[model samples]
Target: MSKSQATPNSAATGAESPDAILFREGMSRAAAAVHVVTTDGEAGRAGFTATAVTPVTDSPASLLVCVNTASRSAQALLANRAFCVNTLGAEDLALADIFAGRTGLQGQDRFTVGAWEKLETGSPALTTSLVSFDCRISDARVVATHHVIIGEIVGIRLGERKPPLIYQGRHYHKL
Candidate 1:
């Protein structure tokens, strides 16, 4: 089964313990889309992969993205108040790993994984990504280990026929 679709009661199948039931349930219920959030401002250029993006409103065109409070990209995005969401293609796994810290790239260096450019909003966007959304911060809130950042999309770039890259259960794929 796909990691995002893992059975919640694996232990019922004799594969996990009851204590981990809630944790497994969390994994099972989390259906996410992987996207790279990028920014460039006084803090310099930076990008990070996230699966926490979600649409919030259609009329005003807002999206919510949860970012780890401790990440550099998170810090930069907050400071900039502008970011680009680069939806990856199936072959962009390496780029995903690079931005996600799985490939050892850090800070601004992570942006070198692929071709990048900028949109009208001055947000850095991946040139070969399946789609890119340039956004401006509308509001934000810090809750526990993550920051819920809401943005209003001001521009968009949709690429050619490219499938999206996905991440779940610490694995990557497309479908």
Candidate 2:
């Protein structure tokens, strides 16, 4: 018989927890589609590049996105109560960098790079995106350093068929 080693539970034993760097490094290995999530309304227009969005259900047609609390668009998204998830095409890498705050563009300036239109929720949708999901905020909650925002789909716009932009290992990739 082999000896089994007992692992200490961090929550119970109050041991040192895994650091944020380690968590991010692990998550970086998971490939995800790139999207620019936008919002406009009483909170003013705002957006940011994100990869944390995912479909929550099909019955009511809903999805969720995790936004960093410090993100420039977080407050606007929460206040506007609506958003659009524009899935980027492989050729849209420049647009992603613009919205991700890598080009020094902030606020409305970031939108100047793309042809934007509004669907049902009045959030800006990229005309060249692979697809856009317009939604109204159904719920939100804070978890760790991010806000988990749930959106109920109100409308959808399909653009030209193209390969989606993917991010993994801390870099952009095309499939």
Candidate 3:
């Protein structure tokens, strides 16, 4: 059968149904870069590891970052109206784990584990990140259990060229 001519089961239900499991499983096969999204302001300093980030357009130099609405950093990200997407290098796995909440760290404590500096938005940017995009939140929309944040690039920091940290099939890979 041609690629698009084949169809999987069509009896799947809604997001909370078995289809959700299947959907997650399917997504696991796709490789994505790992990043630590950080924000700091009146709300507070907060950061989290995530893979759900992408460029939306270059005309405006914007990107989208998806954060769970219940994430510890959500409030700060919204209140600050800005963030920094720190793309990790392969050597930053432990940093990613700390931000991912695997180390039981919270809020500013996560920053203690990494080297950080402030960028255009005054958001904490990773000094050792492969690259960091400092941005201002242009818009935010809630979808399912997460907030899709639209960020307009205000500044960008490029670090040394190195293998990036990637996630696929529930594991981290360097490339």
For TM-score, the strongest prediction is: 2
What digit string (tens of lDDT, one per residue) describes model 2 on residues 1-175?
Answer: 1223233467998987656676687789999999999999999999999999999999899999999999879999999999999999999999999999999999999988979999988999999999999999999999989999999999999999889999999999999
Candidate 3 wrong stretches, greater than 4 Å? 1-18
**Cα distance off (Å), candidate 2, residue 5:** 15
Query: How much is 73 displaced in model 2, in angstroms?
Result: 0.6
Better of 1 and 2 by lDDT: 2
Tell how far residue 56 is off in model 2, in angstroms: 0.4
As a whole number from 0 to 100, the lDDT of residue 2 in candidate 1 is: 67
| Ranking of all candidate structures by their lDDT, best first | 2, 3, 1
TM-scores, all candidates, are 0.83, 0.91, 0.90
Error of 3 at 44 (Å): 0.5
TM-score of candidate 3 against the unseen true structure: 0.90
Candidate 3 lDDT (Cα, whole model)? Answer: 0.91
Per-residue lDDT of 10-122 in model 1, one digit per residue for the tens?
64676754345656556656656789999888877888888889889987888899998988788889999999998888888888888888878788678766888899768
Indicate the worst ten consecutive residues by lDDT in candidate 1: 16-25
